[model samples]
Target chain A: MSEEHAVPAARLRTRGLHLAYGDASIIEDMNLCFPDAQVTAIVGPNGCGKSTLLAGLARLHAPRGGAVLLDGKDIHRLPTREVARRVALLPQDTQAPEGMTVSELIRFGRQPHQGWLRQWSDEDRDIVAHALAVADLQQLAQRSLDSMSGGQRQRAWIAMAIAQQTPLLLLDEPTSALDLGHQLEVFELIRRQAHTGTTVIMVVHDLASACRFADNLVAMHAGRVIAQGPPDRIITPELIRELYGVECTLLADPVTGTPILAGVRRA
Target chain B: MTNAGSTRAGLGVTFCGAGIALAIVCLASLLIGAGNTGADLALATLLGQSSNEEARFVVYELRLPRMLMGLAAGAALGVAGALLQAVTRNPLAEPGLLGVSAGSGLAVAIAIALGSSATTLRISVAQLGALAGCLCVLAAARTRGVGSDPIRLVLAGAAFSGLLFALTSLLLLLDQRTADEIRFWLVGSIAGRSMDQVTAILPSMALAAVLILLVIRSLAALALGERTAVGLGHRPELVRLTVVVAVALLVGATTAVAGPIAFIGLVVPFAARALAGSDIRRALWLCLPLGPLTVIGADILSRVVVQPSELPLGVLTAMLGAPVLVAVVRANRLPSL
Candidate 1:
């Protein structure tokens, strides 16, 4: 996206990142960079630490070994609010108080920019309106999120991240609980945002969908990246077999010219 | 579950209507007192057909101050309850249940046992104790994963309150005279209170007002949960700190003035949430008016129901507040915050 926009890119780099829970190490010396304005999908099996890697990037999880640097400074060194302003993260499972409207949930995306004195501003209003419209949530804004269908609620949550207006937004399994249509709806929203120059990093289980939607894919296995690059290069059958421990054939999606996983039986 | 919007409006209008009813009860209050100086002569004096000196003393001097204290005490409990419930995001989270009042009560009991004859000083001590209790509970709630379980927090609160209350009872038992002095007060009644206690508590009440204003925004953010609250740039620690201080001050002041009234906080906030929807800010805002209304109204009920002898305000509040608590627990099934 930055290559097309011609704006100078600020790299998000994780150098020698190590994470552990008590005694067990989850990630070890993981050095990687999320290229600016690119939709990078971290794909792996359950407990492979793709979500953990995403959490480190969003500053939600503190690193045990090295630094997650946005530009040159360590993200942990920044104030939580400042990191929030620059990097917005949507955790896989988010909840709101009962009776909260869709609009109210999305408006919280403006949290980083809002303070007591500057509670209501024209800029905030515009951003909230735009987010709702972009997510096709305007008609449902006034409706209570708990009362809505799962797909509608997911869209509302996505709308909230969109409203944050940060260049770098990370989503952890945004499509985890959705049906096929709902997953496509969420994926399309991610794709559209990426097209508009926002850096969307998501953890996805579906490699085919990631290949179709993500501009770049970082395939992982056992807390390490197996490959990182464009889907056509990274989604090869050899890489897929290594990442998932399954044998599968990969071919071009005739429609989008993206890598398509044609057949899959567990190895 | 009750629709918080229409429920609040209904309660507001009902509580307001009850306020008018409270005025009539206040007149009944003016008509009677513990003073031996009054009888039917006070009634004629109040009606303006007669002005017996003894009747005037009974009505103006004795009954008026007691009536005023009841109103203030009830309002304080109600507001404190509403604040606790909103801030904690637990409908069952009343200050009394959380040991905030017991903390205050324990301090006053200790003060009484210490041979402190100074009433004004005991007020401050009670407030300090309430603040300590609030801090302990908040710390417990925020540490790591403990805050995640709402029911566990409520249970912790109940245990904390029971411990403090038990300690207070022990302190009272150590000194017979102090025990006699504190027994009715501990049970919570506005009987025999002087205007001096009311004057002593006004400033803390004012401070509580200001503190509530400052944290209302953060509490609203908190309703979205902690990470979201941090994401909004409002420090969750600061918000919790401010709320604890405000609740402590309010609970302390009411304890000082009324001697540890229970259930007004639980019921008032419960009712307010039923009316104002789930927005913490909106609930807090509505609680201001609703708190005093519920308290004063309850006080009036305490007066008329017993008629000749009169019941303790705390007893009535407990009776009303407990059923509301049962309803709240049953209403959500999941015990929603």
Candidate 2:
């Protein structure tokens, strides 16, 4: 638990955001607000525009009409480096150069904060160390990324985002390829990050895990937000059916008292 | 902390070792040549102990200029290869292999065919042609399915290079005077090129060096993938464009001087990465010295192997580089960047 410099959590929202790929419109007139310092998961069926929305929020995609706002200002209006200092993104399917170590990958997080004359400083080094510790990757810092397991590799990437030291972090399918144990490992780490007053927004594929882990769940259907609220208030059979065309029984987890989908199948 | 420190030390040692080797190779280049002047005489003349005018002329006027040309061209080609490979995120994205050299060669051949004899004008024409070649290969790579497959990109470049080579040969055939003037130059040699020609390319090389420094960090971020590089606040498009221009300047200037020397760009950077891992920053540092070392060493061997009649520098590099290219292709996996 190294003492990271205290920064105010950033508020992110979309104001009638319209996203498209060339001539095809994906998300049209979408309005949403991401609560500060919370784990918010955007869950939807495939091609429902959840990932596209995340990319828009991360400023990786430009809006076809409207804009994404950070705090009180339009994100697109700010300098790219300034936005990077406030928001960090972990893109899906990242491939680092072969033989790059965990520490080496994490050091790149400091690039936005660095300049030609001022490359490595004490602060950069400290932040990288803290990120490694936060991701539980301190022991594996020197190991090449290609030599690591999938779980460790994922953690290494997450550690890089953490090293960026941004108040808002956006991840696309953070746990899509992980096994149950690895998923839990990553989710728990995300929870810890959110608890530290960093805003965490992720696009998740699993409804069960999304309901279990997210403080707030946003369900999308056909390029629109179908339902959104705390998992307990929003995890209904009807919502489940609308999302996946599947019917599922809901149960309460005894330990955490969160909603859990059971006996799921197509309707 | 200790591991990182040790790795940094290792890189420093490698850099120093390469520098020393480059110096030795440079000295060898100055001493050895296809002439009556022997190494002992050259050494004596260098030490100012001998007044032999033939040794002085051979060492100072001929071999010195040739070595300088080798050093500059070698470094430019090596850096160009490293930059292209890093930007493309493909190990096979070599300037020579990807037709950049051939593009410049074709441009020079066309200029010579049109009776353009000015070396300065030739350098600019060569650079413009190299830029066009770079854009063509990269544009082809970016089309639909080719970008994802590194081999396909190389194949396209090979095809493009073959077409350019055919065009150059056609030009040579149409003009016998052009053929007589360019026959030896087209084979790629540093022999008999004057000091003025080497100095002509220095400004462009210096410019390329500065551009490389400005984008080195961004280029490393680029290796993490495009989206990631963008998220890191780097303009991937800008970084890529800068790299292409830098590659054009380096490869173009070198090709203008050395007549399309192949494989120094491929082999030098390949060896640099093998020694320094895949980080372009470290690999680039190694490339600086290794480029000169490889070129000058090959140049020395070319001079000594066939006595009285020297081999073309391009032929020697091609003979040495083709095996490396084959090894890269035959590897278990094409180590991405």
Candidate 3:
């Protein structure tokens, strides 16, 4: 391709990444790049390494080989505080101490920017307030997380990540165990975040929703990426069968034109 | 933001209230004692008036040292307890129950057996033992099933403490002549400790205070779990180790001067959290005054409850702390560590 026609490089890239728990290797020789300002979903069945890959990217799990690059440098080598300022991760399950108000929980996100010499500042306060507003938690800011509903609690957690004000956001099943309505609520927030020019990457269990919400979809099976592209182009009946070992048909959503899974049965 | 600012101000007010309570309790500790010299006489002596020799001696020599000892020991135990609970993420975690104090007791017992009577060396030896004990509890918590579950960690601690207690008893049986010296360390008390003993432990307490200030922020972040703490630019393992060292120093210093006063760590942290929410940072701030307040209150109560002969300060704290422990476990939901 001509130089001008070449696509810009992704903000986050994995160069032959390898990960393992003890002696059992999970992801091996994986190379992928998640472009900036897009919602990228990593979808797979059980025993796949989607969540593990995300953990490696977030530096929660160190890779055994190669590197995870943020912008153009190796992320592992960067100072921890600098890395936190550039990326934020929200695992599937998170907890706050008892009786901690929503505002208090969100305030913890400013830890990277805070020190003994410099505690609370106007910018920190403004960002935390902005995070609460974006998460629709302005009214519940004073309420304790324990008193909130499942949906509200989840939103509060996302608000904490939002308060970090990172350009890259990573979530592991951000809506798991929530009802359909709550799922949509969280996904809408994630979508809004992505629309604001943040690169949002999430490990999504539901392929249909992943296709519906994400700008790009990465499909993995048995620790390797099998397909990746725009959801409309990457998702197919054969790909679903290969990933899940189930017979299924793919259909386009009437309203959004995103790929949707229809009839399915055991193969 | 305005609401948050107000909430913070409310916390500041709570801390001030606790400080005032501490001052009142310290005065009470100075004024009241189990002796012929009454509170009126002690107050007269404190007011710079010419009082009888007995009253001046009682307030200056006896009550003054004891109250100062209570303040230092109380603050140490309370802060140590809070640090243990925060690092383990178990509200029930206490130095006394987790064998830290028992560890100090055993070390002192060994020291007495070895004929090391120097007060300064005893403090160091006790602190070293307490460090070992803190490490043991942490090791137990790190074991697979025990680390994550609060009750299981407590159970492991209880078991470890029982082992240390048994070893200490064995040391007592082996050395009969040193029984008098070891007896005081076993059943902790604030009485009869000279100013020299208090001075000896002050250095360790100061060191612990510095360490706590350094790690308190990271300990708060750890409440969100280890991964979240790491994600926030904190080194979770390093924070946990620093907390353990700080706990060992505090517990050792307290045990050195006042014996292994039971439950001050547990009760102090419990009360601090109650008065100032669950954040370790806030709880620790409250712990400063609340520890001395609770310890001195218990010390005064120990003197008054049994006239002519004071109860061991450790005994009173245990009586007050055990119920709170049960109440915490039975409260349907234990506060997240």
1 or 2, greater by DockQ: 2
Worst 10 residues of 2 chain A by lDDT: A1-10
What CAPRI grade goes to candidate 1?
acceptable
lDDT of 1 by residue, A159-254 (tens): 888888888888888998889999989889888888888888899988888888887888888998877777877677777777777888778888
Error of 1 at B131 (Å): 3.2
DockQ (model 2, Cα): 0.56
Tens digit of lDDT per residue, candidate 3, span A83-168? 98889888876878888889989998998889988998999999999999999999989898888888899899888989998999
Local accuracy by lDDT, each model: 0.77, 0.89, 0.87
Q: Tens digits of per-residue lDDT for model 3 on B1-337? A: 1222126787788888888989999999999989998988788899978559989988988989999999898889989999999888888889998889989888988998999888888888889999999999898888888877888888887888899889888888888878877887678888887888888888898899899889888899999878787778888888999999999999987887788888888888888887778888888988889998998999999999999999988899899888988888898777786
Candidate 2's C-alpha runs over 4 A off are A1-10, B1-6
Error of 1 at B70 (Å): 5.1
Pairs that collide, model 1? B4-B274, B4-B275, B7-B275, B8-B275, B81-B265
Task: List, in the given order, the native-contact fraction of each candidate.
Answer: 0.37, 0.76, 0.54
Q: Candidate 3 at A124: error in angstroms? A: 0.4
Question: Against the true structure, whose lDDT is highest?
Answer: 2
Docking class of 2: medium
Name the better of 2 and 3 by lDDT: 2
